[model samples]
Target: MVWAWLRIAVAVVGFSGVVAGFIVNVDRARREGQDLGLVLANYFSLFTIVSTIILIVTFVIAGLWSLRNPGRSPEPRGIALAIAGITGPILLLGIVYNALLRGLPSEIALTDPSGIHSLDVWATESLHVIIPLYLLVDLFFASRRRALSWWSLAVIVAYPLLWLTYTLIRGGLTPDPSGAHDWWYPYPFLDPHGGGGWPSVLIYVAVMLVVLVAIGAGIVAVGRLRSRRAAARTSPVGAAG
Candidate 1:
């Protein structure tokens, strides 16, 4: 559908922007002339930690609300759970790992010339990998409403995808030696020269797209199947009663 394709494209662009923006700003902090390292570090810390915390609370509320109301609101419930379940955990993991694995004291974050820092890699991938999966589930559930179409699905998927793409490109396009060294698992797809070249990253993207779409289709099938079973269960029993 036209809407579905548009939604998918939007997600791709959004993903790229968020990552890329964060990376460029991080580099700007490290550059000798820009030595806004102290200022930017403080700002980044302020925004990143605070925003992540806020998002966790946001998803939790959404999850709680969805669970309280079922049946007629099944589509909304699935969508809420997708984001709350995935993003919420990723945020929690980042907070735990950043504070625990990195040995940062309470109320502190460490950022230095090592590009950004290891904690960032953990947080970034944790968020990225999970989001696509969430979008996949949302598309499936949303498509069932008669008024909606496949295009609606695509539009929804595209939002986060695009935001993340922006962020990733902003980070490493110039090919920083230090950045490459600091890069972590699962996200080497963003490495300069595409690492094994653009082909590698493109393959990764293709795979992600397929997995996301498949997961959505599966969700849609399951929801429909369950609905049918519920209807059957209710109908005959109503006659008997």
Candidate 2:
């Protein structure tokens, strides 16, 4: 009984990741001299196109994986993180990174292009929804508890937040090749200052930070309320035990 809303939320997050990837590539190409009006017509960046196809295939596989005996006991943390890092929207950045490289002109491919958007930025921004979706999935006849715990919620919040902070500190969210060549490459979404200019970079980050903070705060509040309820329920039981 996977919750419908969780499924929808997962789908939306994936869709948004794909959109961000595509937009970043297009923006990268534009900065590289592709005409804005006729970008698709002239742009033959085939690597990413094929990469996108692979992502679609991978996503299908991931969905199938999700449907297989989902109500079992908790998944090993490593496995879920692997799936999140490689299969889900979270991994889209890495995959798209490969695509970007493949899409580049060979002579200048190693030049390390700029980003159209930030992957870390997008994931953190979207996590405001994705984590709750996961919580709801946990609620779908899975957990006996009526709601999620605050600690559980905190772990969930840290997923995207931690990643976002890591990316920014290491120059992840921008398109500049300097950041691209690092071990954590392909973070077009995180590369704000690359071609967008300082004004654009500051503006986007400011707005994104505000929205993400608000969302994180709401999640924390919800978890606190649930924790209080759970504590009240447990007090009498504890005395008996």
Q: Lowest lDDT 10-mer window, candidate 2?
A: 41-50
How many clashes in each structure? 39, 14
- Candidate 1 weakest lDDT stretch, 10 residues: 142-151
List ranges where model 1 is wrong by over 4 Å. Answer: 1-58, 66-152, 172-186, 237-241
Measured with C-alpha atoms, the lDDT of residue 93 in candidate 2 is 29
Error of 1 at 46 (Å): 16
- lDDT of model 2 at position 139: 32
Q: Rate the local accuracy (lDDT) of all candidates.
A: 0.43, 0.42
Model 2 TM-score?
0.32
Best by TM-score: 1
User: Which tens-of-lDDT digit does each residue in 1-241 have in candidate 1?
Assistant: 3333333443443344345446655564455344454334433432233334434444444434444543343435444334423332333334434543444341112334555554455444434444334444443443322222333445334534663465455444322323433322223444445558767766756765665455444444555565665567679775576
| Local accuracy of candidate 2 as per-residue lDDT tens digits, 10-79 | 6556556556545654665556664454444222222223323433444344445556636634434433
- Which candidate wins on lDDT? 1
